[model samples]
Target: MAAAQDPSLFLGFDFSTQQLKVVAMDESLSVVHQSNVHFDSDLPEFRTRGGVHVHADRLTVTSPVLMWVKALDMLLDKMKEAGFDFSRVKALSGSGQQHGSVFWTRGASETLKNLQPDQSLETLLQDSFSVPASPVWMDSSSRKQCDALQEAAGGALRLAHITGSTAYERFTGNQIAKVRATRPEEFQKTERISLVSSFAASLFLGGYAAIDYSDGSGMNLLDIRSRSWSQICLEAVSPQLDLLLGDPKPSSSILGPVSSYFVQRYGFSESCRVVAFTGDNPASLAGMRLQQGDIAVSSYCLPPNSREVKAVESDTVFLWIADPRPALQGHVFCNPVSEQAFMALLCFKNGSLTRERVRDQCAGASWEPFSAALRDTPLGNGGNIGFYFDSQEITPPAVGVHLFDPQDVQVCSFSPQVEVRSLVEGQFLSRRLHAERLGYSIIPGTRVLATGGASSNNEILQVLSDVFNAPVFTLDVSNSACLGSAYRALHGLSAESGASFFDVVKNAPEPQLVAAPHPEAKEVYDQMLQRYARLEERVLQKSRP
Candidate 1:
């Protein structure tokens, strides 16, 4: 039996795009030992750049499914090497990069359950994958399938109303449709489809793991209002979709004990329970402990707008009725902790990367110069606004830079100071505009939780605060997803021990107040936002077919 106090530890894993990170926390929720296996640096055998194989088409992005399995094998062995005892761990859970998938062969489950204690997992399951390469979220080659599925469901608006977002090529539903159309035989041989989150969960469960409700929302298959798979969407995508995609369960549902593979191989206690893993965003939500009105503004690899929303109570177990109102452009996912609430997220393809591009061009590629530029220049750049899209953007769906002056006339030339301020102000202004359109408000007492690596920059956080006109706070810990998963492990196990999720993690270090909005800066940004709207309209008009 696991100890109740000092020795009790919970293990949480976060399998992200570039690396697989694990954190071990004690009963008090303090991190004990943390480690990671970076895919590009650690697994040189895969020969992958940034953990993915980007095709020449630039629209097709994939990763080796076996690379992830191999990563798990190495991660555990590395943990054992660090003198950590697996026996002290009471429970385990994980978070994965949302929407990526993995396919298993016919005998893969048996292979997983019946692993040899003497040998490693990679050697045992080398041939376990039926589809060697899995399409990830960066993939956008399924435009043809997205259009067809949208048409099959009546239209884009109707489809968004049903699935919580308009049909996007990156969604798993469209990717699966592309596979069925091009490679029918591979789809036939496939027995099950698992999201990246559940695939990591299955490794510990010793069989096929069911997708969790929170992660399933990204696949564009779950009925946002009903919280179940939509039959119309299933038929619209492919036949027997239900069979291929197993039933999804709540994110906190604990599966069985640790797999015999781990118990025998790594000396993991047989009593260690495996909590259902979820997507990184939902894990972050749980980690941040966001309430009904709070917003999680992440500046991670991608900028994702995560807002917690309340759902109406229903008598039926599953409501198949579609939401009659027009749906927001972002995704709606079930809250991992609270079943009664859900989260809506909007991801912008051009995030910090776009800002970094402008910084490199205008500020000599150093953040010190960029920070100085922000501090020296006045807010709104004297009514000079710019839109910088170094890559394809989601909200406006346009690329290339456009700059304007106070009189709404185009400006082709500007100094580095003007360029630097415009980039920062423009990015946040666009976010504020889209956020309000999706029902988020910047009223008094509204707290914006800023996270991710870029959040540490005071210049960036200051802009976030001034534009949103709310106090911006940053967490002490950097990896919110892993920390959240660690909390989930404890939260699931505490059910029998009588401590709720909040009861256990309430004392975990509080977020520091990093930046507060300035009334003077707020006034300038409000006027600049109006100019941004008009400039965006003129640019979109010029780009129209």
Candidate 2:
């Protein structure tokens, strides 16, 4: 169905983990315009020492903020070159990788005011350090802070009960605490911290500070039930509230208008409205039009939860769970995993790039040829190899550090082809067991949605399908986050009329295609999965510090 009136054009900027994607869509959700740009920025510094006793080895992690800004500039240039009129664009919203944050000093206000419409990025970059680079969500140097917070809050479960998530290395609170503990000077200098999503939105809207709940949930600071900052958590962190964080906002709230300087410089319409930003995963879920029972899965690897316990003799354990009631609309079972039913996510962080590298070095083969070779290979890769993809491990036999050796760390693999297959099968078996432990039955009939960069590869998808004994669904949208952002924007518009979130998604566009499992490969995969578990257990025991 068409919108009641002709829907205005919206430009969605997705600040993702690897790149920035910009899309222009009308009310019908048709991609009337689009542009993508790739970029990277330096990581943050973990420690600074000036005295004689100072340690020479310091940990530094890069943030994606500068990359985002540069990409946005490039996208605008491309849009202008394409001859898309800036005046027709009516709204602006963004989707960014969740949890990562940008710390903006009060000094940013002055630089933001002086920004000319035609100012070059070089000029901006020269002053870009005015605010420290955004702390990316993937940085894991905050373990000390995470442990401290858990101790301060009483326990891990208590902290998780306060925040929706347990203490993670990537969560914003731990990152902020790390800054405070390591570099008190910089922490004092920081004026306000905003998640990447909100920070990008603030830039377009001139300058503002407000976070969306979906992104806030990833911070481990927001009280999910209250949809606001948790006093208990704040007291535990002892953060200078005014400078360290911003007021939280709903996902759809209009933060402000695009600055006149940006309008004149980027040639964007003055009528553009800046909406709140959300995490990429949450955006993808919204974009897929996921319903009450619809599951949203990602192929990206996740860190394993060390706190997970196997079910015991007691059928019902009365644990004080974090009441997700504030965020819940209706009665629904919510867990550490995705809230959607039967969410079978299988992530391989080092999956695609590693596979490409392997093919390049060993076989001197292209992606298509290598994938075709994989097809010829039998289930469980003919029992000739066991490939372990170390993207993210979430359940039993969790292995975070990369381990490619059983004996010497420097020993080289004798067979490159066998090594490659081992990595792939490792990820497949890990996902299967993870889902099963979560109370999901891993059978031939289970349907799984495969997304992320790895999802685009038919070989990877097929291998996953065979290994898991389930049908793998691939989405048409190359960037699920951007599409999800658009879905959220449409929902925001529809929400003005007080429409249900499900109703809005139901009226949205349908997915591109659905890939089913291969029946012949199921039994072989089941046997191989058991072998993978044993290998993983032995490997982890040897690798521990």
Instruction: Output the number of the TM-score-best candidate.
Output: 1
Q: Encode model 2's per-residue lDDT on 272-375: one tens digit a residue.
A: 77777777766665566543323334544332222223211100100111223221011112221122221112233444445556678655667765676666
Candidate 1: which stretches are off by over 4 Å? 1-5, 55-58, 300-329, 353-381, 413-418, 495-500, 520-531
Candidate lDDT values, in order: 0.79, 0.59
- Please give each candidate's TM-score: 0.87, 0.68
Q: What is candidate 2's TM-score against the reference?
A: 0.68
| Pairs clashing within candidate 1 | none
Local accuracy of candidate 1 as per-residue lDDT tens digits, 183-219: 7888777878888999999888888888888888788
Model 2 steric clash total: 19
Q: Model 2, stretches more than 4 Å misplaced?
A: 1-7, 17-19, 40-58, 64-74, 107-130, 240-244, 256-271, 288-347, 350-426, 436-446, 452-470, 500-502, 505-509, 512-514, 517-545
99 in model 1: Cα distance from truth in Å? Answer: 1.8
